[model samples]
Target: MASKGLATKRRQESGRRKGKEDGDKTRGGGGDEMKAGGGSSWAWKTKTENAKKVEALREIEQLEQKINNLDREKGVHLYNKRSDFRKLFCTLEEQELKLNSDRKTEKAKLRQQLNKMRGSVTKFQRELHNVKPTPEFVEKLKEIMETIESVVSEFKEQQKQIYEELLREEQTLNQEVTALEKRLESWASAPPITIETKSVKPKTVSSARNVIADLPPEVAAFERFLLQTGGHRGGWDEYDHGTFLRIRNKFKGKSAFLDEAATSIPGRNITDVRQHENWYQEYLTLMEKKKDGIQKWKIVKEAQKDECLTQAAVDEDEKKEEEEQKTRARARRLEEERREQADRLNAWKVQKELMKAKEEEKQIEIEMRRAKEYEKERLRQLEVRNQVQEYLQRKQEEDAIQRLEVESKKAVQEEEKKTMSREERVRFLERDQRRLEERLAKGKAKEEEQRKKSKRLERLKGQVEVQVERDPSRLYRLTEGWKERKKDTTSASNGPVLHMPHRAVPSWRAGL
Candidate 1:
């Protein structure tokens, strides 16, 4: 029994070790032995370093595969790569959102450029449509078109420079990343072997002061500035500042100045440009004031004490160079303003032409609509006159047809009378007269009888009314007599009727 229990315990231990090994393998351990460490455990180190490396390598492989799968046609890679969204489990949604954002930005840039050119073209077209062609107008339109082309070309050049700058930055970053990755791989492949020694070199602890000493004064100053201004809003980096300078140097004017600057710089918007502009203007003014103060101090120093001739000569040369630069800058600014004003005048002319064209079109439409309305009224009047004429003609035709029918009937009657002999005609007349006289006599007798009957009913009704007035109880008796008379009259006129005692009186005998 003791041996069996020991065997069972050993088996349980083996099973647990097997399970742990399986878990480790499943976790990408690849059955490698993990040595015990003094500080962080092997598992923790693997999770942090190895896991991160593996994830990065996988991402790189996926990117490479995507690149390989891209279309070989020129410029298709730019479009096709953005359409790919195979990173579903990790950053698919984020990549799609980024792609959409990039597409929208590109579209917006294209739309802005197109709108500028389109405005000029549409204005020219409107002017051409509304007003007669002239040499002066043609020349002006040509000039405007040329100006639009130049502006577009300048904008394109700025975009090209910005793209080149971005490419250089990306290449430099990639190079640094590759170098660091190579170093990490080399270290990982062959770790340094530590040997136990009795004597150890004294380790020097590097502090912030040592770090500051190692860096140049300019770098340290910049770092200090960065730290001091970290809490301030709308801070731009050196690259952004350089980009702003380039854009400012290229384009100048109040019209779309901020917009152009913002669009030219990737990731910088109008608000950032405005903030930078304010800060830069203040900085320039401050620097100018500072330089003036320095120059005044130098002059005072020279007057109060002896100064080197070489240094004085250098100072004069520097002051002359500064003045020249200021003059050049001023001249460039004035030129830009003149160009902008000309552009504004051209835009106003185009707008006025478009409005004039629209008004002419509206007036022409109104006139055409009035003409159509007049024509429609004339056609309606003609239709009404035709209908009236048709009605009169139809009435005449109907009257003629009726008259012909009466004449034909009369002819037939006359023909029949002519065919009859004289004596036969006389006998027929006597017979028709006798029949007519008999009908008249019967009608008179019936009318007289009806009148007498109505008179008798009236007498009866009056007697009943007089009795009812004299004795209120006599109403039922009179009503019963009236019912009997009604039954007799009904039997004489319409054979027989099954009379109900409660039946209402007929409307013709209601008075009785």
Candidate 2:
């Protein structure tokens, strides 16, 4: 029994291990699809997975295409932005250039304006300087002003005369218009003829005034009462009446309706309310009678209205013809007046034009003469100015030459005095000392030679004296030769020789 149990246990353990291995194999092969009894499922899953993979790949491609499209759009957008920025920058640059040019132009204009103003100021100053403020000048100015004022006053007087004439013509036109308007009013005010229709009764009511006149005493009394009491000041107005009616209707079958109505009406007593109710009832009855009468009147009036309109039309046509004739006459008169005014204006214009032509000719001649004189003065001034400029230019050139010479001398002195280093200064001083020593030595040697020549001459003179004792002729020849030699030596010593001047060393250089 134990062996059977052990065998069963071992078999169970082996089966479990095998199952685990099978699971690992299946997982290693290809996941859940490789499990037992999964062939159809595996194929279906593979197909589905392939379809899903294809769909995923398609989605990824779509996404990639979208990304590429986005990138392309971004590139285009960036390019557009860059172009816009470039355009804007170019625009800004152009604006800046334009502004710079404008500013330069403005500066030039300002400079020109300043120059013009300066010239004007100078001219004015010169004029002021040349002017003499004399009584004669003042009197001339006053006379000129008076003459201008007189001319202006004369023009104003002529204008006043023209205005007076226009006012007279306007008054005449106004009077004629008033007469025409009065004639029209007279024609319009003529009484209209009454045409009685034989078909209807001639006694039918026509106007409200006739209706009132034909009303009974009771209706006249009612109308007078209504007029007296129906005002808003101390009466039951339409609003009060409406309120009273509304309250009365609301309280219709209840007690004390008049009191309620009076209360509801804002400002009315029971007595007034009762009277208003009575008047309203009587008004309703009167309105029915009035409506019947108005209907009868309307029928008669309508029949008469047609005939009256026909007569009125005929009368209007006649009036229109008369008005047309009047208007034509007025137009003819206006035309004639306008023609006369035009003739007068034409004559005035011609006269004014002739006067203006004369004035303008005189002014032009004066201006031309003044311009000629002014041009002569300007030429004279310009010539004088040119002469002055030439003289100033010549003086300036001479002064510049003198200044250049002075500046060159100063530059040389400054360089010599201030530009030397200690070593250079020592070198220059040593060189100068050497040249001075050389000059002194040459002078000393010349002095020694002159002294030696003097000694030799003395010796020769002594020898000549000794020889004179021996032979007078030989001594004389020797003395003559010595004299000639002395003359030659003196001449040679007096010959022109250049000497360098000694310079005094500055205190600073001496210290250095």
lDDT of each: 0.60, 0.60
Model 1, 1-512: lDDT tens per residue?
12223233333343344444435444543323454323457667666766666675576567656644442221232222332222221243354446546546655675576567657656765665665488887788788778877876886687587557655544444433443453345345442322222254634433322343333344334333333333112256567777787777767635367888888888988988987787667555544664565466446545544434445455666566776998898677657755765797799999999999999999999999999999999999999999999999999999999999999988986776566556665877999999999999999999999999999999998888553347767755657667777664544657656774785554433543
Residue lDDT tens for model 2, 1-512: 12223233333343344445444444445644365655777777667766765675576568657756654544443334323344434443454456446545644653454445445434443554456689876675566556555654664576467457655544444433443453345335544445433355635323322333444444444444444444222244568877866776788725478888777776678888787777666666665665566566556666777768886765676667776998898677657755765797799999999999999999999999999999999999999999999999999999999999999988886787766566667888999999999999999999999999999999998887553345657744657667777664656667777876788776656853
Q: Name the 10 consecutive residues with the lowest summed lDDT in model 2.
A: 1-10
* Per-prediction TM-score to the true structure, in the order listed: 0.21, 0.21
Off by over 4 Å in 2: 1-225, 231-234, 251-256, 308-316, 323-512
Q: Please give the lDDT score for candidate 1.
A: 0.60
Runs with alpha carbons beyond 4 Å of true place in candidate 1: 1-321, 332-340, 347-355, 358-366, 369-377, 380-389, 396-512
Steric clash pairs (candidate 2): none
Query: Best candidate, lDDT-wise?
Result: 2
